[model samples]
Target: MKKILLITILSLLFFSCENLDDGIKNSNSPNQFSQNFGQSVQRDFMGQVVDENNNPIESAIVKIGSNHVNTDSNGVFILYNVNVFEKFAYVSVEKMGYLLGSRSLVPTNGINKIKIMLIEKAPITTVNSGQTSEVNLPNGSKINFDGAFEDENGNSYSGSVSVFAYHLETSNSNISELMPGMLFAEAQDGSAKVLQTFGMLNVELAGASGEKLQIAEGHTAEISMKIDNTQLATASSTIPLWHFDEENGYWKEEGEATRQGDYYIGNVSHFSWWNVDAYQSMTTLNVTVVDGENNPIPNLGVTLTDQSGFISSTLTTNQNGNVSGLIPTNNSLTLEISGAFNYQEQIGSFNSNSSITIVISSASVNTFNFSGNVLDCDNNDFSNGYAVIAINNYVDYAPLVNGTFTSSYATYQDTFNYSVYGVNFGNNEFSTIVTGQADINVSNTVSINDLVVCLNSNTINLAGDFNLVVTRDDGNIYTFPNEIIQLVSPNNYKTTTTGSWAAGTIAQDQGYNFSINNLNGIIVPNQGLCQGYYSNNIYGENYNGTSSNGLIINNNEFYIQYTITFNTGPRIYTCHYIRN
Candidate 1:
């Protein structure tokens, strides 16, 4: 029994040991299997990010192959845990306000250390200030701007301010919204710094400035300052500066005023007041014409009248609905703009010393007194027809449709009758015609002294059982019967029968003679043939006496088709008659 007890104990201990061994084996087997199946891929990359000033940028993003990483506070970034022998990877560094940088690196056996330096991004400088100061600089020279910052009440700010300078390229005009120049410097201090190495200079003021600026030559060097935020008004003044003339490669400052080949340099600030006497003076005038929507009117005719009869000129508005011109001196001026649709005349006077814009709206008063009617060939009114009435000349072959003749004169009538009011009578040609209709009158050919009425009629005639025979001076007789006739005549005529004739008979056999006569007389022979007869028998007595069947009629009994050859003269006629 003791031996059995020992064996039982031994057996229990062996089972316990086996359970422990199984647990250990299971854990160890899993670890060994994972070691054989899984693998760790490490990807390493390094790069740097900087600003346009070549200063290191922090918190930049770095991308290696498919892995992404960000730089610490020092603008350094790296990627790890990448497969070394898998494939070649790329390193990219990205930062705001800096150009993106990228590089390729092939992983070796161990940790791959790649150093990438990112380039500074190009600066983006746009002109957001309304106050533009253009400075002309000498070639191969530079300009440094130094100015003090002040508040709206002329108090200086105590904090460090940012300063920016722009070199105005050829594309930097006052009308442009973009500043196409190299950024000279962006300094955080209040000291002066050079902005551009060449071309014109434009300074942007961001911190402070008073309503007015005081600039002196000796007290301060050539400097540009930021105007006060309260004084940051959109209103601007233009001061024209004279150019420095160079002759034979030498600077010539004398007799610069009368030179023909002169150019402009820049604007005159408060510092330029010392040389204000020698500054070439110019007067600027701003002109603007607008429609009812206040949109700029393009291709407007502008006239400036002084003592001279009239100085006529034309100008088109810019995108800002304004036009500018420079005058030599100040004088009383009257501005007139013609050829504006739905716009009135805008006239005013001002001292032409500074840039000014003249805004012209539609005229308040209607001008010109005009009246006319549009009539058809039958002298009937055209009910819904439009007429285009031009004063001087006809521009188009067709009448103007939906077009305004003047500010107050418009034609929308099928039958037009207008009394043009307040018209300044000059050498004017009045041409009025209906749209899509034949021109009834050509006033361009008529003289101002003779406002004669031109009457034109187009006649369509049906053969009225009468044969017409035309006897020409050459003794050639042309006959027409049972045919439609088209004739143009000044005096419209109706068909009338003169002699009695029988039915279904040739017109020449019928006792009827027709004649056509003009003012000159005997244009066409009085000859016609009737096809039917009409008789009014009284008391059943047939008064069928042949009333001279052979008739010699004069040039008055018959109406003939005719066309006018010329104006102010007798109409030439070509007659057609019927003969059997």
Candidate 2:
């Protein structure tokens, strides 16, 4: 029994050990096996599929090794999971309408990217046989024989071919004559040779109208041509070659015919057309008129007269105050404008189509009348043999005046009368006068009240100096400085170191100041006599070749005060001195 029990225990132990070994082996067995190592091996491919016309082909099949993909909407495809075991893989792409395309690709351990381009097969619609129909040519163009022909399928055919052209000599009849034949060879070789028969028919029609086909005034013409075995014929419908006058306008018809149908057909009339006649003519002569103030004159009437006579037309000024008149012929013309507001008559002339500008100035109405008596420094009347009143500053007024005024010595008082005529004020100068006498030293004071009188009046004052000679009891002549001297306004005196009359120098021996009063010609001394002479001794009696029996005074050293009044509206007073 003991031996049996030991055997049973050993058997049990052995079985237990066997079971443990089996469990261990079972646990070690692989659950799933990896076909490709640890790397995620994938194959990538892209390609474009296009037709003969360069149009994208969709749904194209792309294969790389055992992998395959379809083209996308843009004719592009991608293939993945290409077997890495293939050192050189065969890649092929195909579509229903495209030719088969293939490429060789080398597989790597990683991703393999490749590009495949597929071209579509030419369409069956392409001409496979050499056959075509003829085409008509335009009326006025010349055709070139050597040209290319292509079909819709992109098939090309090249060979020598011939074409015929027909021209109708007259529209009145339907008869036509065959022109010289044109021959050409296709640039490419293929089934496209059939398209050559339907190509353009080049015809050159030349006659009176160079290279243009013409029909009679009233007729129709039939044109027929042939290419290889094809024939094409057309007839021009009846049309009027010349325009006819109608009540409304001129009428005619123009149209074009083709194998499909007639096109660009319509009836044309003069109302839809226009005739141009161009010409040139002399229009007018532009003229500008200005007043004395150089301002444009508005509404001024301008008369035009030619050598023959006055053109009965008159032109008025525009907004810019310019006048222009149109004349038929180019000739010399005269223009005139009436005077206004004390203005003188103005006349001007110019040739036709020429421009003229006229300036009109105001005329002088009357001569200036200056009547006054010579007075002394004490406001006493000057008694002299002859008191001569001379104007030194106003040289322009000298021509307008008669003999100047002179004081009479027998009267013991001098009454001066002076008239300045036809004096145009402001153009030349303002008026100034100097008075002197022999023997008795007489200083005169002259006042010009109307320096400028229009809307506003200005007053001017002027003074003159003179020396007197007296006979003493011993009958000897004695010369002395005049007691009555002209006094100038302080504002008119200018002090300069280098001037003719320097500062502190004696401007004149006698000085008297005068002013305008009551618009009357009256002489009175406003200031006492000045006791200075000119530094340069200017305008002395010796230089002027004057009789020195009386007191000699420098006229250029006197001072003159004047005022100016503008018509439009400003009033100004100016004071200035005359230097020797």
Candidate 3:
């Protein structure tokens, strides 16, 4: 960093506080007044003081009309016994190393809490060019240049230099004036006009739009300063150039200028204007959009906006997924890109003369539309229940009226398609065909019109206990409460406590449907002399492979044929065995 000379141009503007509110009692001095408003009444006011950076300024002096106080370590201050009728009052804040802040406060319902932000004082600069120069001035003030002059020959000119500091106005003043009640005196005859002997030259505002020559927001204000000397300047040295910040009401040192022949070039961030003692150009910006696979993704919308309030433009990517246009180089730029429904939107920031590529992830969107019917075991329309379809954990429901239902976006898929409808519970009002397979793909419209969902009306009561007898191969018999066996339920029409095959008590209302308990204690008469007691036709093959196989003795309609292989050959033994 280079140490350059900086001068404060303080133009103080004063506001008229002459007319005081009638409700408020006036004192000769602003700092002198009664602690009480009237009638022993008091109104409290609280506030905080901070710098432009939002850091709290502790011990700062705060004045609310006649009452004054200093902020604590937390930068908080309070004023008590304020006149309630006074709608507004002047508040002045002062702290070292910071510019003074003053404003008017309007109390609501006799109370108010406020936050005051104070701007830091611009650093005073000293100039040393073989000869050193320093301006002796009072504190809390800035210097303003009245005018600049030069001889026709462009040689060093000498004249009287007059500087003035203006006071900020209270009544007619506005926030735009950084410091309130501050101004400079008018330059007089024989005043020191020419501070130093320097040739006059031109400082042009590059990239300025109109006759007003204002720099656009988000665009840099290029300042080109030409020195009368024919010698070319280099970046190794420095030229002092400052940009005025309207918000902070101060002048700040701009970046170093690049030397080109007799001209020095510098860039200003914004148009609030610049006082340069610098020149300018920028180029086209190109943005590319690609997928996570690094392949070009075309037809994406890209917009570039200047952060400094410059004009913004939008363009669409070409087949190559690239968009290019002339963009501002005077300031920072922001890029916004958007693409297809599945891809995510992106925003990026870049500097001047920047061209970059953005990568986005391609997302897969899957949605399923279902048009199906809900039916009972007899293939009859089931109208009492609602229709529900779940795909990949995303479920959509519709009312089942007249056995028909239609749902949309009711399914999602990844890798493969799997969906179900109206078949959530094992104990349902109608038999359900939950294992039906439907072949479908993602992002495609598939009609599930043939999806015939069945309902099962079986419900088991686990509170009651039931008994079952099992005969093992060793000829040992074991009796147990149905709860002791796992996964032993018989059919889709029967409900079990376990989702898999399990032995459990059946509800009284449901047990009668299967009538498995009737087989208990029934004796079988031996019909032949071959061996063990056997009945000709008893056990049926209907419940053979179901959970009810071990418990149900017979279905009463078909006889069961048991095939036993003795390792030598397949021996088929058919018998109807009843429990005694």
Best by TM-score: 3
Model 2 scores a TM of 0.15
Q: How far does residue 547 in candidate 3 sit from its true spot (Å)?
A: 15
Q: For candidate 1, lDDT tens digit of each residue in 1-580? A: 0000000001001001112122222222323322321234564333334333222344467665456765532233444465432222335566643334444323433334333444433322322122332332332112233443344455543433333333333222221111111111112221111121112333333343313233223223243222212222311232212211111100111111111112212322322111100221233455665544454544344545443222222333422444454332444555655553333343444454344455443333212222344333354443222222333321111111122121122111123232221110111112222222212142211111111122221111221223666443335555544221211112112233222322212232233222213232213223322322222110111112322112223222333433222223323233443421
Ordered from best to worst TM-score, the candidate numbers read 3, 1, 2
Per-candidate local distance difference test: 0.29, 0.28, 0.36
Q: Judged by lDDT against the true structure, how good is candidate 2?
A: 0.28
Q: Model 1: how far is 48 from its true place, Å?
A: 64
Q: Candidate 1 deviates by what RMSD?
A: 40.5
What RMSD, rounded to one decimal, does every model reach? 40.5, 54.1, 32.9
What is the clash count of model 3? 70
Q: Write the per-residue lDDT of candidate 2 for residues 1-580, one digit (tens) a residue.
A: 0000000001001001112111222111122111111233454343444433223344567765457776533344544455632222445666643335554323443323333344323221211113342334444312222223322243342432333232222121111001011011111111000001122222222222122222222322333222211112222232212221111111122232233232212221111111110111223456676655565654444555555432322333432346543442445545555323222233334333456667655431111223344333343433221122233221111111121331111111233333221111221112233333322233333332222212122223122212333332234443333222222221121111111222122343222223333232222222322232212111211112323211112232332222222233322121223321
By lDDT, rank the candidates, best first.
Answer: 3, 1, 2
